[model samples]
Target chain A: MSEGERFTLAEARDLAVKALVTAGTAEGNALSVATALVAAEADGQKGHGLSRLASYAGQVRTGKVKGAAEPQIERLSASAIRVDAGAGFAFPALDCARDALVSMARSQMIAVAAVYNSHHFGQGGYHVERLAEQGLVGLMLGNSPQAIAPWGGTQGLFGTNPIAMAAPRREAPPLVIDLSLAKVARGKVMAAAKTGQEIPEGWALDAEGRPTRDPEAALAGTMIPMGEAKGAALAMLVEILSATLVGANHGFEASSFFTAEGPPPGVGQLLLAFDPTPLSGGGFADRLEILVNALQSQPGARLPGTRRLTAREVAERDGLLVPAAIVAEIKALLR
Target chain B: MSEGERFTLAEARDLAVKALVTAGTAEGNALSVATALVAAEADGQKGHGLSRLASYAGQVRTGKVKGAAEPQIERLSASAIRVDAGAGFAFPALDCARDALVSMARSQMIAVAAVYNSHHFGQGGYHVERLAEQGLVGLMLGNSPQAIAPWGGTQGLFGTNPIAMAAPRREAPPLVIDLSLAKVARGKVMAAAKTGQEIPEGWALDAEGRPTRDPEAALAGTMIPMGEAKGAALAMLVEILSATLVGANHGFEASSFFTAEGPPPGVGQLLLAFDPTPLSGGGFADRLEILVNALQSQPGARLPGTRRLTAREVAERDGLLVPAAIVAEIKALLR
Candidate 1:
C-alpha cells in the first residue's frame, strides 16, 4: 500500500463492482452501487464513497442485505407509485421510481414515489440531479436511523433526515440542493473522533443532555438540529412523509446504517417530480436563467451544487487520490 | 382610544369585515379575508394579523386589489387545479384551492393547486393547518414581492418566500411548520427602525451590500438569507414552484404588498394535499401518536404548532389586546 496512489473513476468503479459481486451482489445491482459510490468520490463526498464498500460487502456476506432481491413496484394510485426494495440496495428501487416518475409527471403534471424496505441511498443529490437533468423538478426526502432529538428533547427520537431538491436550468447545470437537518453530518464528528480532535460547541449534546465538544460523546448522544427547533420540525416532516406515510420502519425502529446490523435497516424515501412545461405553460428556462444569472453575478455568492460540480471536473481530468491502504482493503474483499 | 382595549375574536372579525365591505369588497370575499386576518391575530402572528387591514383597505380603494372580482378555477390535470385570483386578495383563491385539494386528494391520494394573480396570503400555517385537521397532510408555498437578493447579488430578486407544512396527529393538534427564507422578516426591520433599535448583526445588509445593524439601512438594502446560500436557494425553489409554475408574476415583477400604488402584485401560491387513508394504511394515526409521545416524553420538547395553538386558546378565552389606535384606524375605514 502506497501513500500517493490514485485511481481513475473507471478504475475505482471497476474495483468496487468486483468487490460487490465477489460478496454476492448481482451484476446489475453491483454496477448500480459502484456507479453511485464512485460518483460520490469523484464529487468529493468521500464519506459516502469508497469508504462504505467494506460495510456494504460485509452486509451482503452476512445476508443482512439480500444481494439478489429484486425490487417490486406497485402503482398505488394514478399519480403515486410505491417500490418495496426487498431488503436490498436502494438504487434499483430508486431507479424504478425515477423511470416511472419521469413519464407519469409529464402526463400528470406531478407524480410521487415512495420507497420502503431499503438501505441507504447515498448522497440524495445524485438521484435528484438525474431527474433535473431530464428537465423535471425533483425532490427527495429520506429517513435514517435516529441521530437527532426533537426540539427541546434530550433523546434521539428522529434521524438527521436529509432533503434534496433540484430544478432544471437552460444554460447552466441544474440547481441542486442537498442538506441534512442536523447542523453538521455525523460523519464529520466520526472523522474528528478518529483523528482525536474535539468538535466545536453547539454541534451535539452528551447522553446526559449537556453540550460537549468530545466527538465520542457527541456521537453517543444527539446531534443538534440545524436552525434549532425549526430544523427539528422539518426533520419530523420528512419522517412522517418518508416513514409513516410510506409504511417504512420509523427512525427508532431502524438499525444503524454504518454496520451490518441485525436486520436490514428498513428505511424509506419519497421522491416527487413535477413537469415544468405543462405546469408553467412554458418560459421556465428563461425565468430560471434570470435567477441563476443574478446569483452568479455576485462575487462570493455561489449556488449549492457548484463545489461538487467543480470537484467532479477535477476528478475527471486528474483522477482521485485514494489512500493506498483503503484501496487495498477494498481489493481484499474479492479475495 | 384607550391603551388596554381588547377585542373578542368575533369583534375583530366583524370589524375587519366591515372595513373591507366599506372599501368595496364583496360581502363573501370580505368575510373570507376577515376570517384569515382575525385568526392570525388570535394565533399571535401580529405581523400578519389585523394590522394588515389598513393596507388591504387602501389597495382595494385604489383598485390594486379587485374588491369585487371572483377567483376563477380551472382544472389543468386530473390532480392539478389552477385558480386565477382576479387580482384580488389571496384568501378566496386559497379557499377554492383547499376545497378542491381535499376532494381531489381523497380520490387521487394526492393533489396540487396552483394559484395566480393573487395578493398577500397571510400566515401560510393557517391554510395548511386546515387540511391537517381534516386528516390530510398539507403543504403550501407562496411568493411575495422582492425583498431579498439572490445569494451573492446585491439587488433583491426574490421574496422572503414562505413555506408551510402540516401533518395530522392522532391525539393532538397537527404538527405544523412555517418559515420564511429571510433571516428576519421585513416587518421586524420596519418595526426596529420605528423604535430606533439596532438589529442584531447577520440579519440584513446595507444598501451597498455591507452588513448593517441599523434597521433603516437593512430595510433600504436587502434581507440576509437564513442558513446563508441554502436559504436563498430555497427561496428560489419557492419562487419557481409558486410563481413560475403557476403562470403568475415573478417576485421581481410583483409590486410591494404593503403599498397601494403600482399594479396588482399578482403573486402566486401552491398548495398540495395528501390523503393519509389511501397513502398510508389506517395506521397513520397510531404511528403519528408514537412519534408525538416520544417527543413529548422529554422535558421542554415542544412541537412547532404548540405555541400558536396555546395562543389561540388564550385569545379565545380572554380576547386579544388590540391597540386602541389600531382599532380606531379600522373603525375609521368603516366610515
Candidate 2:
C-alpha cells in the first residue's frame, strides 16, 4: 500500500499469469495460481496476495519450488486421500484435493484429504468456499513452520496453525470462518518488519520470555501463545491433524520458506467435505438458509464470509486492486 | 459436591448403570452408556456425569429416548460414514461410530463418521481418548440443544456447542481439549443455581435481554457466547459439522432431549481419526514426546488434559470421596 496504487482484478491476474508463465509454468497452472493469488487480494487478505510473488519468484529461481509440476493424488480410500504436490506450490495440490473431495463426498457423505509438500496455500477460505459452492460443507486445517512459543516458554515451537470452515446456505452467500490459533498471525510481524512498525504487547515475547513491542525483538524472540494455554492447546490440535496425522513436518522440524528453507516446510493440510443435502433429509439447505436469514436479521450481524463475498463482488464489478509495487516486482521477474 | 460426596468410579458406574437398566436398557447398551457417564465424573467433568441421571431417567420414563435400541449404520463409505442411533442416546451411537472409524482409519488412513438422531453423548473426550488409545489421532465435535445466542444477538439460536480434540502424545497423557463455545457452559449455570449463587453479568442475559445476576433469570435468557462473536462463529462451525453435515437437528431444532420434546434432540458428532506413524514417519511420536517434555518443563505448565489425568491418579491413589447423601440419592435411583 505504501509503494503502490491499484489495478483491476483482471489486470492483476493477467500480470500474475504472465509472470508465472514466463517463469516457466504451464499455461493452465500459471493461470490458476495467478488467479488464486489475485483472488486473495480481492478478498481483502492482502497478506497472501500478490505480495508473495517475489518470494515465489525467488524460490523458482533457486529450484526450491517447481512451477510446472502438476499435483498427483494417490487415493487411500473412497473417503480418504493423499496428494503429493509433485514438489510444486499449493494451488495445484489444493485444486486436486478439492475436486477429489467434492466427488467423493457426494456418495460417501464425507471425505478427508491431506496435501503434503505444497507451498503455502493462499487463504484457505477460498477452497472451502469453492467446496460450499459444490454443495459440501468444508473444513480445512493446516500447519506451517514453527512460529509462536509454547505457553510459559520463550522459544518458538508451533506455527500460526490456521483453521477455516465453510458451509453453504440456501439462497445466501456461503458461511465461512477462517482463523489463526496464534493471537496475531506471524504474517503481521513480517508485515510490521516490512513497514518498520511496532506491535502491541501480549501478542509476543522476547527471547527472555518478556513481553515486548519492538517488532525486531518480537521476531528474534517468540510469539506468546494466544489466549494463554487455550491457544497453545489448539495449536497442538492443529499440529496433530496437519503435521503428525498427515505425515508432514511437525513443530520446529518445518522451517520457514520466507527467508530460508531447510526441508520444503513439509506443510500439511486436512480438508473435509460433507454433502449437506443427504445429511439434512432435504432440509439441510433450507435450515442453513433460515440460519443465515436469522443471522442477517440481527442488528449488527454480519454472516461469516459476507465481507469476502462482497469484496469479491466488488472486485468483479469493478477491478481487482494490485499494488503497483507488486506489479513492478512481477514485471521485473518476468523481464 | 455439597449435597453429595464423590463416589468411587466403579460405584458410580454401577449405580448409574443399574438405574439406566431399570429404566429399560439391556446389558451392552447400559454398560457402554453408563461407562461414558462414569468416565465424565472420573475425568472431573461433573457437569456431564451422574448429574444427568435424572434427566436420562425422565427421558426413558416418557419414552422420548430409546433405552434398548441398536445404532445402525445409515451410510458407509471407505473414509466417510453416517450412523443412525435408532432414536437412542448418543453414548452408544458414538461408541459405534468410533469403532467403525477406527477400522476405516486403519485402512483409509483418515476417516470421518457422523452420528444422527442421538441424545447427549456425555463427554466427547471419552470417545476421542478411546480412539487415541488405539494410537490414532482423534478429533471430535458435538452440538446440543439451543442454549446460546449468536455473538450480538439477544435470543438463543445455538446449543452450548462443544468441540473436542485428542491426540497421542509421547511420555504424557493424550492431549485433549473439550470445551463449550459459550462464556460459561449451561452446566455452570446449573451448578450456580443449585448452589444459590449469583451468575456473572456477562455469562448470560435474562429474559428480555437484560443482564441479570440471578442464576434462574439468566437461565431463562440466552447464554452469552465466549469471546463474543468468535464463540458464536465457532458454535456455528460446530453446528454445521455436527448437525447440518450429519443430517440431524441444528440450532433451535436442537432444543429437544435436553429441555423440551418435539422429537429426540438428534445430537450429532463428527469424528476424525488418522494414523500418526504413517504421516509423521518414525520420529513423529518421539518429536511429540519432546513437546510433552517441553510442556512439562514450562513453569506452572499443567497439560490441558492433565487435570483429569491428575484427578484420576489421585482418586485412584486416595480412593474416591463419596458424600453419604449422594450415595443415598444414587441408591434410591438404583432401587
Candidate 3:
C-alpha cells in the first residue's frame, strides 16, 4: 500500500465506473460492480479487486457479458425470490436480491434469494454484510468456474465455491465469516511456480491424482480442497445449493472467470436471510455479545474477519494503493 | 450380524420404548425417542443408537430429563416455529418441528423451526431426512456439551456441533450430508486410551495446550476441530444458530450428555426447510440428477451418504446385532 499509487475510496469507485462505462457497461451496473471491487480492495483482497476490471471489461466488449443487461427479479413464492442476472455482472443482481430479501425476511421470518446467469460476485461477504447491516442474519453461497476436483476424482467438478455468513451486532459492525472451499487459491501455486518454489504437498494433486509438491504439476492437476474430503463434501453442497437449485450451469460446465475468450460463465448464487429478532425471541443481539466477549477474551483467539476490518480502517484513513501497471490498464479502458 | 444377539428393527424399537417407559418417560415421548434411536441403529450410527439407551434411561430416572414433559410448539412468526422441549428428550420436539416445518415450507417455500430445552438429538440427519421425505430440502444444526476448544485457545468453548443437510431427489432417497465439526469423535480417543494405543497427532491437544498422540493425555484435552480454524468457525456458527438464536444454553454452559448427575443439557437445535420445486422453477429434481450422475460416474468418488443407505438396506434385510451387555442393561431397566 505504501509503495503503489493511492486513491481515495471515492476516486477508486469513480475510476472503475468510468472505465466500465466506457467499455459499454450500464451506469448503475458499473457502479454496483465498482463498489464491490473497491470494497474488496480496501479489505486487502487484491485478487478480487481492481485486478478483475480488465478481464470484466474485456468480457463486456466481447459480448461474453451483456454489459447493459438489466437484472430481473421475480417473487417466486412468499419467502422465495429469483433474480435473473441476464448474463450480466453479478453485483447488481445481488443488490436486487438483498433489497428483496430484507423486507421479505422481516415478514416471513426467513427468506431466500437465488440469482442465476450471473458473473462473479466478488467478496461474498459484501452481500451478506449488507443483510447483516439491516438487523438480519445472512448466509450466502455462490458457485464459480471449476477449480477443485471431486474428492478422490481427477476431474475438477466443483468450484472453489464460497460460503459467507454474517450476524448483526448491537453496537458494532456485523461479524462476517467468509471462506472458500479450496485449501488455497490457485494463484498462489502459479506464483510459486513462477518463483521456482515447491508448493505444499496437500495444496494440490498431480495429474494422475497423486499428491504433489511440484507447483507445475499441481497446476496441471487440480487444487486440493480445504480439510481434504470434508471440504469436498461442503463444496458439493454449495454447488447443489447455488447451481443445481438455481437451474444454472454447474461449475464444470461454466466458462473461465479469469478470461473472456469463451461463453458467459452462467454461474449462480443463493442468499438466505433470517430475521433473528423473532427467531431468537428478541435476545439474539445480547446473546451474541456474550459469545463475542468469550471469543475475544481468550489469549491468541481472534475473531474471523478482524484482519479485513483492520485493513479497511487503514484504507479509509489513508486511501487504497493500487499497482501502477493495473491502474494504467484500467485508465486505457476509458479511451 | 452373526456374532452378537440380533433383533429385528421392530424389536429394537419396541425394546427401546419399553426401557424408556420403565424409566418413567411418557408413552408418546418414549415412542418418538425409540423411533429415532432405532433409525440411527439401522443407519449404522451406533454412537447415536442403542448405545445411548443406558445413559438416556439413567438421566430420565434421575429426573435430570423430565420424563413426561411434552414439547410445546408455538408459531413464532409466519414462517418460524418454536418447539420448547420442556427439558425433555430431543426426539419428540424435533418430530413436532419436522411436522410443522413440512407444511410451513410447502406454503411459504421456506420455513424455520427452533427447538430449545432439548436433550441429545441422537442423529442430526434423522430429522432432516424426515423433511426430505416430505419433498423439502432440510438443513439442521445442533450444539452439544463442550468437547472442542476455540481455535488458538486451551479451554473448551464450543461443542462438537453438527450440521446436516438433505436434498430430496426424484426417484431416489434424499441425498443427506451430516458432519460434526470435530476432527474425530471423543469416543475414538477413549477407545485408544483403553487399549493403550496412540491417537493421531492432529486429533487432539494435550491439557498443556500442545499436540499429543498419547490417548490418555488427549482424553483430558480438547478435541481438535475438523479443518482446523475453519472447522472451529463453523462450530461457532452452529453454536450461534442453535444455542444463541434459540435462547438455550451454550455448549460450555450445558451439562455432559454422557452423565445423569448434572442438570439437564438444555441444548438447542435449529432446522430449516425449503421447498425446492418453486425455487428451482420445477426443475430442481432433474438438475440434481445431472450432478448425481456426474458424481457417480467417477470411479473413486462416492456420494456422501451412500454408506448409510447401504447399511440401512442390510439392516432391513438382516436384523441388527446388539451387544449382549447393552441388551441386558435395557432389559434390567424394563424389569
Chain B TM, every candidate: 0.97, 0.92, 0.97
Estimate, for each residue in B54-95, the C-alpha lDDT of model 3 and write its tens digit: 899999999999999999998976678888999999998999
Clashing pairs in 3: none
* Best model number under TM-score: 3
lDDT of model 2 at position A138? 92
lDDT for every model? 0.86, 0.76, 0.89
Quote model 2's iRMS.
2.6
lDDT of 1 at B238: 80
Worst 10 residues of 2 chain A by lDDT: A255-264
lDDT of 1 by residue, B1-335 (tens): 36857889998899899999999999999999999999999998989999999999999999999999899988877788888899999999899889989988888778888888998999999999999998899989899998887777776778889889888887778888888878778898998999999999999988788899999889888998776665676677788788877778888889999988999999889899988765654567787788777788889788777779999999999998998778888988988
Worst 10 residues of 1 chain B by lDDT: B276-285
Clashing pairs in 2: A8-A320, A9-A319, A9-A320, A147-A158, A247-B279, A247-B280, A279-B247, B5-B323, B6-B322, B117-B266
Can you tell me which runs of candidate 3 are displaced by over 4 Å? B1-3
Which 10 residues in a row give candidate 3 chain A its minimum summed lDDT?
A1-10
**Candidate 3: Cα lDDT at A34:** 97
* Native contacts recovered, each model: 0.52, 0.46, 0.61
Chain A in model 3: its TM-score? 0.97
Docking category of candidate 2: acceptable
